[model samples]
Target chain A: MQIIIVVLLSILTILIIGLLLWKWRVRRQFRKEEQKRRLRELELTAIRSQMNPHFLFNSLNSVQNLVQQNKGREAHLYLSDFAGLIRKVLNNSEKEEVSLAEELELIRQYLNLEKLRFDFEFEVLVDETIDAHNTQVPSLLLQPFVENAIVHGLQNKRGEKHLKIDVMKKDAFVLITITDNGIGRKAAKEIQQQKNGKGTKLMKERLNILQQKQGEKYKLTTTDLEEGTLVEIVLPEEK
Target chain B: MQIKSIIVDDEKHGRENLAGLLESHCPEVILVGLANSVKSAIQLIKNEKPQLVFLDIEMPGENGFQLLEHFADINFEVIFVTAYDNYAIKAIRFSAADYILKPINFNELKTAVEKVTKRIQKKEENRQIRELNRNILQPDNPRIGLPTNDRIEFVEVKKIVHCKGESNYTHIYLHEKKHLLVAKTLVEFEDLLKEYSFVRTHKSHLVNLKHVVAYSKTDGGTLELSNSDKIFISRRRKDEVLQMLKTSIA
Candidate 1:
């Protein structure tokens, strides 16, 4: 009877030791996974930070020009609103994704800021057909495309510059089209041949990273329109 | 002595912050005007004619360097402010220009202001031939505008012993008793004198190869001018300076 009790006790101790070791292994794996997630978050935040300075500096330049022309009050007001918008975007930088409505609002704020510089010469047409509640986007993913349109597309042109932004739902996918009417394809081609600077290269790299994050279901396309250029992006529903 | 000053920065907060700091710390510095961009900054510098300017490096549209390009001549002192990290700080060190980092420390700010004040005083007092040499090399364009003082008249490049940039001005040490004050920075003069035998051995100091008397290696190497003044050649540029000296001598 004593021998039987000893054998039973040994079996119980072995089982407890084995269970503890298994738990330790699982916890280590969990810690590593958590660390990777944090690192990814940091990388995304860094990308967003890099984008902010380029946009902020450009807007400030506009305000400076206005102020120089003796338009101090206008410049002051524009700067105040621009700072608020920048603060809002920075506050949202930490998030993984934001609702489509919030993204659109931020884009509107950016457009308003640009409008201060361009005046009545530039126009933005937003399509109201897209559902804002259901759709989500990576924060600040769309503004750069619009900015590219203004800078590379419109800035050098003589006449009116028009930017049309369309958002629509097709089946389970959300489609966004940003088109600009400015300098023709031939001019852009000429410019491209002359210089390939850091700005365009950075934009392409950012788009690639964003595409990878959205998976194979998403698609992005850039086309040279007769009068200008168009950037189209499609995001499929998450599984 | 009251120091006339201008402030230029793209950011509203930045301009205000610098203005506030100057007001509170350096009461002797008289605020003349404030500019937010390259265009306005150029205008203010031309109009106000300040003796000193606190300038920001990076601005929207055209940067601080672009502002320098607009003036065929500059008569003001500039202290650059940058938000860049250590590598950029080192680059400024290599250029021998004074700059303050962002989140400005009050003590450091005070020291920079004091340095400029002392330089101004030295210029006014008519002492220090080295400082006078620095003024002769101050013209942004060596060929066009060379600043001259009553004591030291502007001499041709052939008569110059060495040229150095102090703040916004260049001092040209001449063979004659007098030195010339050129109202331009070092980088400006560097571009203008590229064709001449003037070689920049250090960030702050440029020497005429025709005036170099002896060259010896110490802490990398040192160049002794005809005036018996020894100027240290930077470690990075030692080889280049040596080669230039050899070829010029030959």
Candidate 2:
């Protein structure tokens, strides 16, 4: 009986050591994987942060011009509003996803800045069925397309410029459409000197990365209208 | 004395906006004519012989800059009006010419007009306009104007080594161990030099990537410039600085 007991105690010790070794190996692998994921996140953030350089600087210039004009009250208001937008962008930098409501607020703020430069009418509509506060979408997914509509379509247009955004619920996906009444893509291309569409390309790459990482369905389509262009983005309800 | 001026912009709103501002704030600027295109602007300039021309740089057929090519000698003062044009703005700044960004700020318009009025009174020649044309034609070798205490100094961008920011002023270090103290802020310099391979390694330091010889990883990180000067890499900017260096070198 004593010999049997001693043999059982030895077997139990060996099993515990083996289990501990396995746990340590698994933990090390997990840590390495976590590190890799963080690096990739950092890279995505870099790509996402490529906001329009022209808009950024031009907005600052507008502020400076206002101050120099001695419109102290107007300058103060413009600067504060601009600062708030910047803060929102910075706050969302680390986040992979944000509520649809927050995203719309950001877009509204951005449009306000553009309004300072161009006279345009803008409107945003949300479907009654969709809850923007609860719906999760990829952060800054639609900015590039909206910017393209303004810069390429409306910038050189002759008459009144109009921009509209519509959000609706469609099956398992959320549909967002951006419509602009400005010069068509073909005309814009003819005028611009081969300035490649780097922003659009970067945005497409980001969308692909997000889709792959999150295992979600994402769709984008652009239609050139007779007067302007329309961009539609369909994203999964849950990111 | 009224300073006769012409407004030339393709956009209707732009023309009306500037016209209204001039009518309201600038009583000294008498509007003689308005042109929608460079072709019309040339005709107006010859017919009116205005003392000032508020020119829009980007138009459909011919840009505002091309209008200058039509004249052998620019007699009237030109103040470029544009919403945004990076290359054109740089050339304008380099030539020490006057420019105002749109959504026309009344104060900026008044200031630009005031300066032009002074120049008109002094009968100063428009040498800067000629310089601007030269810079536009030869964009490969761009120069930057640094304002000193008394006068402005124009230097080729490639010759500058680095810059140090102190309070509001900046000390510009150039090649051959020469440096100049300018009245401009480091932020302004950074904006101008950013596209020209200048990187801000720290809040107080902006360095030319071309002048960097080596980067050391010891004690966080440090950069050894071609001038044998050491610049520290801030903890926050270490990753970005390395990334910029990699792209610049490759």
Candidate 3:
């Protein structure tokens, strides 16, 4: 009976040891996942930070050009609006995600800022069917796409320059389309091949991080259409 | 009490925001003509002869520092505006220069305006030698100035080794034996040195190209100074520094 008791005790000890090892393995996995999340957050923040200054520098250049040409009053109005918009961006940087309504407001502000630089040449279209309040997006996500449209698409185009932005919801996903009547596919391919433009490269990086964090829930793509170029972003509806 | 001011920025918004702030807070500021580019700023300086300028550090083709290069003579005070925080800002502060961060804070704006006012007031009492010395430094130039215990010394283009930002003061290492302490911060020195051959290798260190003895590829990278000091190059600046080094060597 004593021998039987000893064997039972050994079996119990083995089970306990096995359980502890399993627990440790689970905890290690959890820690690694947390670390990855933190790294992604840092990268997203870095990308978002780059967007504002990039746009600011370019916009300021446009304003400077206008002022040198003696358009002081217009420059004043443009600057006032730009300041207001930038203040919004700075305030929003503290939050991880912003409401679709807030994002739209930011986009409107950005469009207005760009309007100052482009004068009457720049135009934006927002589809009224989409309810922006129900959705959420990464802050400053839409602006870069719009900016890319302007920089790569509309800036050097020969004919009428127009930027068309469409926001629509389908099932559980929110789709944002920005199309610019600028240069054709050849120019875009050429520009990308040059690898000199920092803006396009930055935009891709931000989109990649957004996809990684959300886990294949966000899709961003660029395609050259007959009118100009089409840039589309589809994001999952926040639960 | 009239602060003679000119707007020196390429952005319409930057110029307007500054103008708006001056109009609202410092009403005594005489609105001088605005300049968009370095060339224009130079022309405006010659023509308008404004005593103060609201300058933006970055422009499209030529940045604000290049504006100083255009002028053989300078007789003005500058308040820099920038969107991003960089080592350059520390350099500018180290030089006793005034600058405001973008999305301009009202309180900071008020302080900068006040500082410009005080400088204008003190300008008359300062000696001609000091004025000439400053002219040699160029009022609109963004090069870092070293400040000693008693007086602020403007560093000539080639004599600087590197600058390390230590708390409130910037420790400027010179090619010569005597290192100086600038009352300004590192961010200020960075701004002042934006146009020079200096680049921020690390958050705390800004190195002059003339003093980089050798560069060693390690963790991120490392630069060996003339004094055999190993300065760690930041990952963000590695590509930029390498490109700059290549150009300089070429």
TM-score between model 3 and native: 0.43
Q: Which tens-of-lDDT digit does each residue in B1-250 have in candidate 2?
A: 7899999999999999899988888999999999999999999999999999999999999999999999998999999998766677777876778988776667788899998898898888766787788777887887777877855677888888899876557899988899899877675687678888998776578899999999999777899998888988766457668999999999
Clashing residue pairs, backbone N/CA/C < 3 A, model 2: A69-B107
Error of model 2, residue B161, in angstroms: 0.9
Shift in Å, residue A48, candidate 1: 5.6
List candidate 3 segments past 4 Å from native.
A1-54, A115-123, A191-193, A196-216, B1-250
lDDT, candidate 3, B124-233, per-residue tens = 32122233335446645434345477555666656778888765577778775558877655655654564677877765678887788898988668998886677887
* Candidate structures ordered by TM-score, highest first: 2, 3, 1
lDDT score, candidate 3: 0.69
Candidate closer to the true structure by lDDT (higher is better), 1 or 2: 2
Docking class of 1: incorrect
Give the TM-scores of the predictions, in the order they appear: 0.38, 0.53, 0.43
Could you tell which candidate, 2 or 3, scores higher by TM-score?
A: 2
Docking class of 3: incorrect
